[model samples]
Target: MSTMGNSTNIFWQESPIGKLERQKLLNQKGCVVWITGLSGSGKSTLACSLSRELYTRGKLSYILDGDNLRHGLNKDLGFKADDRTENIRRVGEVAKLFADTGLICIASLISPYRKDRDACRAMLPDANFIEARLLEDGLHEHVRQEIQKAFTSLHVLERLKIFSPYLDLISLHSRSYIQPGFTGIDDPYEPPLNCEIEIQQKDGDCPTPGAMAGEVVSYLEEKGWDVYQQASGSNM
Candidate 1:
Protein backbone atom coordinates (compact mmCIF):
# COMPACT_ATOMS: atom_id res chain seq x y z
CA MET A 1 0.00 0.00 0.00
CA SER A 2 1.15 3.55 -0.74
CA THR A 3 -0.02 7.10 -1.08
CA MET A 4 -0.84 8.22 -4.59
CA GLY A 5 -2.21 11.68 -5.40
CA ASN A 6 -5.47 12.26 -3.50
CA SER A 7 -5.81 8.60 -2.53
CA THR A 8 -4.09 7.06 0.47
CA ASN A 9 -3.06 3.46 1.08
CA ILE A 10 -3.70 2.43 -2.49
CA PHE A 11 -2.08 -0.61 -4.07
CA TRP A 12 -1.48 -1.85 -7.59
CA GLN A 13 -3.32 -5.03 -8.39
CA GLU A 14 -1.56 -7.60 -10.54
CA SER A 15 -3.33 -9.43 -13.34
CA PRO A 16 -3.28 -13.20 -13.92
CA ILE A 17 -2.89 -12.80 -17.66
CA GLY A 18 0.10 -10.78 -18.82
CA LYS A 19 0.52 -8.58 -21.89
CA LEU A 20 2.49 -11.29 -23.67
CA GLU A 21 -0.42 -13.69 -23.38
CA ARG A 22 -2.79 -11.06 -24.70
CA GLN A 23 -0.48 -10.33 -27.61
CA LYS A 24 -0.28 -14.01 -28.37
CA LEU A 25 -4.06 -14.24 -28.35
CA LEU A 26 -4.41 -11.25 -30.64
CA ASN A 27 -1.41 -12.15 -32.82
CA GLN A 28 0.03 -8.63 -32.65
CA LYS A 29 2.13 -6.52 -30.33
CA GLY A 30 0.40 -4.00 -28.13
CA CYS A 31 1.18 -0.35 -28.84
CA VAL A 32 -0.17 3.19 -28.69
CA VAL A 33 -0.41 5.34 -31.82
CA TRP A 34 -0.84 8.90 -30.56
CA ILE A 35 -2.04 11.29 -33.27
CA THR A 36 -1.73 14.95 -32.31
CA GLY A 37 -2.38 18.24 -34.10
CA LEU A 38 -4.50 21.37 -34.16
CA SER A 39 -8.30 21.37 -34.53
CA GLY A 40 -9.50 20.81 -38.13
CA SER A 41 -6.18 19.15 -38.86
CA GLY A 42 -7.89 15.84 -39.67
CA LYS A 43 -6.65 13.95 -36.61
CA SER A 44 -9.93 12.08 -36.09
CA THR A 45 -10.28 11.35 -39.78
CA LEU A 46 -6.82 9.82 -39.87
CA ALA A 47 -7.50 7.84 -36.69
CA CYS A 48 -10.66 6.31 -38.16
CA SER A 49 -8.92 5.57 -41.42
CA LEU A 50 -5.98 3.94 -39.67
CA SER A 51 -8.27 1.81 -37.54
CA ARG A 52 -10.20 0.65 -40.61
CA GLU A 53 -6.98 -0.18 -42.44
CA LEU A 54 -5.77 -2.26 -39.51
CA TYR A 55 -9.11 -4.04 -39.26
CA THR A 56 -8.96 -5.03 -42.92
CA ARG A 57 -5.54 -6.49 -42.21
CA GLY A 58 -7.08 -8.52 -39.33
CA LYS A 59 -5.35 -6.50 -36.59
CA LEU A 60 -7.17 -5.26 -33.53
CA SER A 61 -7.29 -1.51 -32.97
CA TYR A 62 -9.22 1.08 -30.96
CA ILE A 63 -9.65 4.83 -31.36
CA LEU A 64 -9.94 7.38 -28.52
CA ASP A 65 -11.14 10.58 -30.14
CA GLY A 66 -10.84 13.70 -28.00
CA ASP A 67 -14.32 15.13 -28.58
CA ASN A 68 -15.96 11.71 -28.16
CA LEU A 69 -14.20 11.12 -24.83
CA ARG A 70 -15.39 14.51 -23.58
CA HIS A 71 -18.90 13.03 -23.57
CA GLY A 72 -17.85 10.62 -20.81
CA LEU A 73 -14.35 10.03 -19.44
CA ASN A 74 -13.32 13.72 -19.42
CA LYS A 75 -16.76 15.22 -19.13
CA ASP A 76 -15.85 16.87 -15.85
CA LEU A 77 -12.79 18.59 -17.26
CA GLY A 78 -12.81 22.07 -18.78
CA PHE A 79 -10.54 23.66 -21.39
CA LYS A 80 -8.23 25.39 -18.93
CA ALA A 81 -4.57 24.45 -19.07
CA ASP A 82 -4.69 22.34 -15.94
CA ASP A 83 -7.93 20.66 -17.02
CA ARG A 84 -6.45 19.90 -20.43
CA THR A 85 -3.42 18.33 -18.78
CA GLU A 86 -5.59 16.13 -16.60
CA ASN A 87 -7.72 15.21 -19.60
CA ILE A 88 -4.69 14.05 -21.56
CA ARG A 89 -3.39 12.14 -18.53
CA ARG A 90 -6.66 10.26 -18.12
CA VAL A 91 -6.78 9.38 -21.81
CA GLY A 92 -3.15 8.24 -21.72
CA GLU A 93 -3.85 5.81 -18.90
CA VAL A 94 -6.88 4.43 -20.73
CA ALA A 95 -4.92 4.09 -23.95
CA LYS A 96 -2.15 2.27 -22.10
CA LEU A 97 -4.67 -0.22 -20.75
CA PHE A 98 -6.05 -0.86 -24.24
CA ALA A 99 -2.53 -1.40 -25.53
CA ASP A 100 -1.81 -3.91 -22.77
CA THR A 101 -4.75 -5.89 -24.12
CA GLY A 102 -2.88 -6.26 -27.45
CA LEU A 103 -4.91 -3.60 -29.26
CA ILE A 104 -3.43 -0.78 -31.28
CA CYS A 105 -4.66 2.20 -29.32
CA ILE A 106 -5.04 5.30 -31.46
CA ALA A 107 -5.48 8.54 -29.51
CA SER A 108 -6.49 11.58 -31.58
CA LEU A 109 -6.38 14.92 -29.81
CA ILE A 110 -5.23 18.50 -30.19
CA SER A 111 -2.86 17.96 -27.23
CA PRO A 112 -1.24 21.40 -27.54
CA TYR A 113 1.30 21.06 -24.79
CA ARG A 114 4.54 19.18 -25.43
CA LYS A 115 5.15 18.27 -21.78
CA ASP A 116 1.72 16.67 -21.46
CA ARG A 117 2.27 14.53 -24.55
CA ASP A 118 5.75 13.62 -23.35
CA ALA A 119 4.31 12.48 -20.03
CA CYS A 120 1.98 10.14 -21.92
CA ARG A 121 4.86 8.78 -23.98
CA ALA A 122 6.67 7.97 -20.75
CA MET A 123 3.76 5.79 -19.66
CA LEU A 124 4.76 3.05 -22.12
CA PRO A 125 7.93 1.50 -23.43
CA ASP A 126 9.84 3.82 -25.77
CA ALA A 127 9.06 1.70 -28.80
CA ASN A 128 5.42 1.19 -27.88
CA PHE A 129 4.73 4.95 -27.89
CA ILE A 130 4.38 5.98 -31.51
CA GLU A 131 3.80 9.72 -31.89
CA ALA A 132 2.23 10.60 -35.21
CA ARG A 133 1.96 14.31 -36.01
CA LEU A 134 -0.61 15.28 -38.63
CA LEU A 135 -0.43 18.68 -40.19
CA GLU A 136 -1.38 20.62 -43.32
CA ASP A 137 1.25 22.23 -45.47
CA GLY A 138 1.94 25.88 -44.54
CA LEU A 139 -0.24 25.63 -41.41
CA HIS A 140 2.67 26.06 -39.02
CA GLU A 141 4.06 28.92 -41.05
CA HIS A 142 0.70 30.70 -41.07
CA VAL A 143 0.39 30.36 -37.31
CA ARG A 144 3.89 31.61 -36.79
CA GLN A 145 3.19 34.67 -38.88
CA GLU A 146 0.06 35.36 -36.88
CA ILE A 147 1.91 35.00 -33.60
CA GLN A 148 4.61 37.34 -34.82
CA LYS A 149 2.02 39.93 -35.80
CA ALA A 150 0.39 39.65 -32.39
CA PHE A 151 3.68 40.11 -30.59
CA THR A 152 4.65 43.11 -32.68
CA SER A 153 1.66 45.15 -31.50
CA LEU A 154 2.42 47.02 -28.27
CA HIS A 155 -1.32 47.32 -27.46
CA VAL A 156 -1.83 43.60 -27.92
CA LEU A 157 1.19 42.80 -25.74
CA GLU A 158 -0.07 45.10 -22.97
CA ARG A 159 -3.55 43.58 -23.07
CA LEU A 160 -2.10 40.08 -23.07
CA LYS A 161 0.13 40.88 -20.12
CA ILE A 162 -2.81 42.27 -18.16
CA PHE A 163 -4.80 39.08 -18.72
CA SER A 164 -1.91 36.62 -18.50
CA PRO A 165 -2.35 35.98 -14.75
CA TYR A 166 -6.01 35.04 -15.08
CA LEU A 167 -5.79 33.17 -18.38
CA ASP A 168 -3.35 31.12 -20.42
CA LEU A 169 -1.09 33.30 -22.55
CA ILE A 170 -2.17 31.52 -25.69
CA SER A 171 -5.81 31.99 -24.76
CA LEU A 172 -5.35 35.66 -24.09
CA HIS A 173 -3.53 36.17 -27.34
CA SER A 174 -6.09 34.29 -29.40
CA ARG A 175 -9.15 35.73 -27.63
CA SER A 176 -8.06 39.23 -28.73
CA TYR A 177 -8.67 38.32 -32.37
CA ILE A 178 -9.97 34.86 -33.07
CA GLN A 179 -11.18 31.91 -30.96
CA PRO A 180 -9.94 31.93 -27.43
CA GLY A 181 -7.69 29.07 -26.37
CA PHE A 182 -7.60 27.70 -29.87
CA THR A 183 -4.56 25.53 -30.46
CA GLY A 184 -2.22 26.82 -33.20
CA ILE A 185 -3.88 30.22 -32.89
CA ASP A 186 -3.38 31.49 -29.33
CA ASP A 187 -2.27 28.27 -27.59
CA PRO A 188 1.07 27.05 -28.82
CA TYR A 189 1.08 23.56 -30.31
CA GLU A 190 4.46 21.95 -29.73
CA PRO A 191 5.21 19.55 -32.52
CA PRO A 192 7.02 16.32 -31.64
CA LEU A 193 10.74 16.70 -32.13
CA ASN A 194 11.39 13.05 -32.86
CA CYS A 195 8.07 11.51 -33.76
CA GLU A 196 7.75 8.03 -35.24
CA ILE A 197 5.55 9.26 -38.07
CA GLU A 198 4.45 12.55 -39.66
CA ILE A 199 1.50 12.82 -42.04
CA GLN A 200 1.36 16.03 -43.95
CA GLN A 201 0.22 17.55 -47.23
CA LYS A 202 2.05 16.80 -50.45
CA ASP A 203 2.40 18.96 -53.57
CA GLY A 204 0.24 21.63 -51.94
CA ASP A 205 -2.60 19.15 -51.31
CA CYS A 206 -3.43 16.65 -48.58
CA PRO A 207 -3.53 12.98 -49.51
CA THR A 208 -6.72 10.95 -49.51
CA PRO A 209 -7.78 9.33 -46.24
CA GLY A 210 -6.85 5.86 -47.48
CA ALA A 211 -3.35 6.97 -48.44
CA MET A 212 -2.78 8.55 -45.05
CA ALA A 213 -3.95 5.36 -43.32
CA GLY A 214 -1.76 3.26 -45.58
CA GLU A 215 1.27 5.32 -44.57
CA VAL A 216 0.77 4.49 -40.89
CA VAL A 217 0.06 0.83 -41.63
CA SER A 218 3.23 0.62 -43.67
CA TYR A 219 5.20 1.97 -40.75
CA LEU A 220 3.71 -0.59 -38.36
CA GLU A 221 4.48 -3.40 -40.76
CA GLU A 222 8.04 -2.20 -41.25
CA LYS A 223 8.50 -2.09 -37.49
CA GLY A 224 7.06 -5.63 -37.25
CA TRP A 225 4.17 -4.65 -34.97
CA ASP A 226 1.57 -5.88 -37.48
CA VAL A 227 1.82 -9.57 -36.49
CA TYR A 228 3.02 -12.05 -33.88
CA GLN A 229 4.62 -15.47 -34.24
CA GLN A 230 2.70 -18.65 -33.50
CA ALA A 231 4.02 -21.40 -31.28
CA SER A 232 5.10 -24.72 -32.85
CA GLY A 233 2.52 -27.55 -32.81
CA SER A 234 4.34 -30.81 -33.39
CA ASN A 235 1.16 -32.84 -32.78
CA MET A 236 -0.44 -31.38 -35.89
Candidate 2:
Protein backbone atom coordinates (compact mmCIF):
# COMPACT_ATOMS: atom_id res chain seq x y z
CA MET A 1 0.00 0.00 0.00
CA SER A 2 1.11 3.54 -0.70
CA THR A 3 -0.04 7.14 -0.68
CA MET A 4 1.34 9.82 -2.97
CA GLY A 5 0.63 13.52 -3.45
CA ASN A 6 -3.11 14.08 -3.17
CA SER A 7 -3.99 10.45 -3.61
CA THR A 8 -4.57 8.07 -0.74
CA ASN A 9 -5.39 4.39 -0.29
CA ILE A 10 -3.19 3.45 -3.24
CA PHE A 11 -1.44 0.11 -3.47
CA TRP A 12 1.48 -1.09 -5.47
CA GLN A 13 0.77 -3.75 -8.07
CA GLU A 14 3.40 -6.26 -9.08
CA SER A 15 3.29 -7.94 -12.45
CA PRO A 16 3.87 -11.67 -12.68
CA ILE A 17 6.17 -10.97 -15.63
CA GLY A 18 9.48 -9.53 -14.54
CA LYS A 19 11.74 -7.02 -16.27
CA LEU A 20 14.45 -9.66 -16.78
CA GLU A 21 11.95 -11.87 -18.56
CA ARG A 22 10.98 -9.01 -20.85
CA GLN A 23 14.64 -8.18 -21.47
CA LYS A 24 15.25 -11.84 -22.43
CA LEU A 25 12.29 -11.76 -24.78
CA LEU A 26 13.36 -8.50 -26.38
CA ASN A 27 17.05 -9.42 -26.19
CA GLN A 28 18.02 -5.92 -25.02
CA LYS A 29 18.31 -4.08 -21.77
CA GLY A 30 15.79 -1.28 -21.17
CA CYS A 31 16.88 2.29 -20.56
CA VAL A 32 15.94 5.92 -21.07
CA VAL A 33 18.08 8.32 -23.13
CA TRP A 34 16.97 11.83 -22.23
CA ILE A 35 18.09 14.46 -24.73
CA THR A 36 17.85 18.01 -23.44
CA GLY A 37 18.85 21.35 -24.92
CA LEU A 38 17.57 24.76 -25.94
CA SER A 39 15.17 25.25 -28.84
CA GLY A 40 16.67 24.78 -32.32
CA SER A 41 19.51 22.75 -30.79
CA GLY A 42 18.80 19.59 -32.83
CA LYS A 43 17.40 17.48 -30.00
CA SER A 44 14.52 16.13 -32.13
CA THR A 45 16.80 15.47 -35.06
CA LEU A 46 19.14 13.43 -32.88
CA ALA A 47 16.24 11.47 -31.40
CA CYS A 48 14.93 10.55 -34.84
CA SER A 49 18.37 9.67 -36.11
CA LEU A 50 19.08 7.52 -33.07
CA SER A 51 15.75 5.71 -33.39
CA ARG A 52 16.35 4.87 -37.04
CA GLU A 53 19.87 3.69 -36.28
CA LEU A 54 18.64 1.49 -33.45
CA TYR A 55 15.89 0.03 -35.62
CA THR A 56 18.39 -0.99 -38.30
CA ARG A 57 20.55 -2.57 -35.60
CA GLY A 58 17.67 -4.81 -34.44
CA LYS A 59 17.05 -2.79 -31.31
CA LEU A 60 13.68 -1.43 -30.27
CA SER A 61 13.34 2.23 -29.33
CA TYR A 62 10.65 4.86 -28.91
CA ILE A 63 10.74 8.66 -29.00
CA LEU A 64 8.70 11.03 -26.84
CA ASP A 65 9.08 14.46 -28.39
CA GLY A 66 8.06 17.44 -26.29
CA ASP A 67 6.19 19.34 -29.03
CA ASN A 68 4.41 16.20 -30.22
CA LEU A 69 3.31 15.33 -26.72
CA ARG A 70 1.83 18.82 -26.32
CA HIS A 71 -0.70 17.90 -29.01
CA GLY A 72 -2.36 15.33 -26.80
CA LEU A 73 -0.89 13.88 -23.62
CA ASN A 74 -0.05 17.36 -22.30
CA LYS A 75 -2.44 19.48 -24.28
CA ASP A 76 -3.93 21.08 -21.20
CA LEU A 77 -0.58 22.03 -19.77
CA GLY A 78 0.69 25.57 -20.22
CA PHE A 79 4.23 26.94 -20.35
CA LYS A 80 4.14 28.16 -16.77
CA ALA A 81 6.78 26.96 -14.37
CA ASP A 82 4.46 24.70 -12.39
CA ASP A 83 2.93 23.28 -15.56
CA ARG A 84 6.36 22.59 -16.99
CA THR A 85 7.35 20.75 -13.85
CA GLU A 86 4.24 18.59 -14.05
CA ASN A 87 4.89 17.92 -17.72
CA ILE A 88 8.39 16.62 -17.01
CA ARG A 89 7.12 14.56 -14.10
CA ARG A 90 4.45 12.91 -16.23
CA VAL A 91 6.86 12.15 -19.04
CA GLY A 92 9.41 10.77 -16.60
CA GLU A 93 6.89 8.32 -15.24
CA VAL A 94 5.91 7.24 -18.73
CA ALA A 95 9.56 6.80 -19.70
CA LYS A 96 10.13 4.72 -16.60
CA LEU A 97 7.33 2.39 -17.67
CA PHE A 98 8.77 2.08 -21.17
CA ALA A 99 12.20 1.23 -19.77
CA ASP A 100 10.61 -1.41 -17.58
CA THR A 101 9.20 -3.03 -20.72
CA GLY A 102 12.72 -3.53 -22.07
CA LEU A 103 12.55 -0.82 -24.69
CA ILE A 104 14.92 2.07 -25.19
CA CYS A 105 13.02 5.34 -24.68
CA ILE A 106 14.35 8.56 -26.09
CA ALA A 107 12.81 11.69 -24.62
CA SER A 108 13.66 14.95 -26.36
CA LEU A 109 12.67 18.14 -24.60
CA ILE A 110 13.85 21.59 -23.58
CA SER A 111 13.68 20.63 -19.95
CA PRO A 112 15.50 23.77 -18.85
CA TYR A 113 15.33 23.48 -15.10
CA ARG A 114 18.06 21.34 -13.61
CA LYS A 115 15.95 20.55 -10.56
CA ASP A 116 13.12 19.26 -12.75
CA ARG A 117 15.51 17.10 -14.76
CA ASP A 118 17.13 15.83 -11.58
CA ALA A 119 13.70 14.86 -10.27
CA CYS A 120 13.09 12.83 -13.40
CA ARG A 121 16.49 11.19 -13.07
CA ALA A 122 15.62 10.21 -9.56
CA MET A 123 12.60 8.28 -10.83
CA LEU A 124 14.83 5.73 -12.55
CA PRO A 125 17.77 3.57 -11.53
CA ASP A 126 21.20 5.21 -11.50
CA ALA A 127 22.58 3.64 -14.64
CA ASN A 128 19.26 3.30 -16.45
CA PHE A 129 18.74 7.03 -16.87
CA ILE A 130 21.14 8.43 -19.45
CA GLU A 131 21.11 12.19 -19.84
CA ALA A 132 22.48 13.39 -23.15
CA ARG A 133 23.14 17.12 -23.07
CA LEU A 134 23.53 18.94 -26.37
CA LEU A 135 25.78 21.98 -26.11
CA GLU A 136 25.12 24.06 -29.20
CA ASP A 137 28.11 26.19 -30.12
CA GLY A 138 26.33 27.52 -33.18
CA LEU A 139 24.44 30.39 -31.62
CA HIS A 140 25.23 32.72 -34.53
CA GLU A 141 23.92 30.14 -36.98
CA HIS A 142 20.72 29.77 -34.98
CA VAL A 143 20.21 33.53 -34.93
CA ARG A 144 20.80 33.69 -38.66
CA GLN A 145 18.25 30.96 -39.26
CA GLU A 146 15.69 32.76 -37.16
CA ILE A 147 16.30 35.94 -39.16
CA GLN A 148 15.95 34.10 -42.45
CA LYS A 149 12.73 32.50 -41.29
CA ALA A 150 11.31 35.87 -40.31
CA PHE A 151 12.23 37.43 -43.64
CA THR A 152 10.71 34.52 -45.54
CA SER A 153 7.31 35.28 -44.07
CA LEU A 154 5.61 38.31 -45.62
CA HIS A 155 3.76 39.16 -42.43
CA VAL A 156 6.92 38.98 -40.37
CA LEU A 157 8.79 41.03 -42.97
CA GLU A 158 6.15 43.75 -42.76
CA ARG A 159 6.45 43.77 -39.00
CA LEU A 160 10.20 44.00 -39.30
CA LYS A 161 9.87 46.99 -41.63
CA ILE A 162 7.59 48.71 -39.14
CA PHE A 163 10.29 48.18 -36.54
CA SER A 164 13.16 48.93 -38.89
CA PRO A 165 14.23 51.87 -36.70
CA TYR A 166 15.14 49.35 -34.01
CA LEU A 167 17.05 47.11 -36.44
CA ASP A 168 20.33 48.53 -35.19
CA LEU A 169 19.34 47.80 -31.62
CA ILE A 170 18.34 44.26 -32.59
CA SER A 171 21.63 43.79 -34.41
CA LEU A 172 23.52 44.94 -31.36
CA HIS A 173 21.77 42.30 -29.20
CA SER A 174 22.09 38.79 -30.51
CA ARG A 175 19.15 37.53 -28.43
CA SER A 176 16.91 40.61 -28.69
CA TYR A 177 14.20 38.76 -30.64
CA ILE A 178 13.79 36.19 -27.90
CA GLN A 179 10.48 36.72 -26.10
CA PRO A 180 9.84 36.79 -22.41
CA GLY A 181 9.86 33.47 -20.53
CA PHE A 182 11.96 31.91 -23.27
CA THR A 183 14.37 29.36 -21.93
CA GLY A 184 18.07 30.18 -22.36
CA ILE A 185 16.96 33.69 -23.23
CA ASP A 186 14.76 35.25 -20.57
CA ASP A 187 14.16 32.22 -18.37
CA PRO A 188 17.01 30.25 -16.88
CA TYR A 189 18.22 27.01 -18.46
CA GLU A 190 20.23 25.15 -15.89
CA PRO A 191 22.50 22.70 -17.64
CA PRO A 192 23.17 19.24 -16.28
CA LEU A 193 26.43 19.09 -14.36
CA ASN A 194 26.88 15.30 -14.32
CA CYS A 195 25.22 14.09 -17.48
CA GLU A 196 26.37 10.77 -18.93
CA ILE A 197 26.72 12.05 -22.49
CA GLU A 198 27.58 15.44 -23.97
CA ILE A 199 27.10 16.19 -27.68
CA GLN A 200 28.55 19.41 -28.91
CA GLN A 201 29.23 21.21 -32.15
CA LYS A 202 32.92 21.37 -33.09
CA ASP A 203 34.56 24.61 -34.22
CA GLY A 204 31.12 26.08 -34.85
CA ASP A 205 30.34 23.22 -37.20
CA CYS A 206 27.56 20.88 -36.19
CA PRO A 207 28.11 17.26 -37.14
CA THR A 208 25.71 15.42 -39.40
CA PRO A 209 22.69 13.91 -37.67
CA GLY A 210 23.89 10.43 -38.56
CA ALA A 211 27.30 11.10 -37.08
CA MET A 212 25.76 12.35 -33.85
CA ALA A 213 23.58 9.26 -33.66
CA GLY A 214 26.65 7.09 -34.19
CA GLU A 215 28.31 8.70 -31.19
CA VAL A 216 25.37 7.73 -28.95
CA VAL A 217 25.28 4.25 -30.42
CA SER A 218 28.96 3.85 -29.70
CA TYR A 219 28.34 4.87 -26.10
CA LEU A 220 25.57 2.31 -25.76
CA GLU A 221 27.82 -0.37 -27.18
CA GLU A 222 30.61 0.57 -24.81
CA LYS A 223 28.16 0.35 -21.91
CA GLY A 224 27.02 -3.14 -23.02
CA TRP A 225 23.47 -1.99 -23.78
CA ASP A 226 23.93 -2.70 -27.47
CA VAL A 227 25.09 -6.29 -26.95
CA TYR A 228 22.33 -8.90 -26.81
CA GLN A 229 22.11 -12.55 -27.81
CA GLN A 230 19.60 -13.10 -30.56
CA ALA A 231 16.72 -15.41 -29.79
CA SER A 232 15.30 -17.69 -32.49
CA GLY A 233 12.28 -16.18 -34.27
CA SER A 234 12.67 -13.01 -32.22
CA ASN A 235 11.46 -9.90 -34.02
CA MET A 236 12.12 -6.94 -31.72
Using TM-score as the measure, the top candidate is: 2
Q: Which 10 successive residues of model 1 have the least lDDT summed?
A: 227-236
- List model 2 lDDT by residue over 72-156, tens digit each: 8999998889999999988998999999999999999999999999999999998899999888657735774675554345345
Clashing pairs in 2: none
Q: Candidate 1 lDDT, tens digit per residue, 25-104? A: 77778899999987767798899999988777677889999989999999999888999999999999999999999889
Clashing pairs in 1: 170-186
**Full-model lDDT for every candidate:** 0.82, 0.83
lDDT: which candidate is best?
A: 2
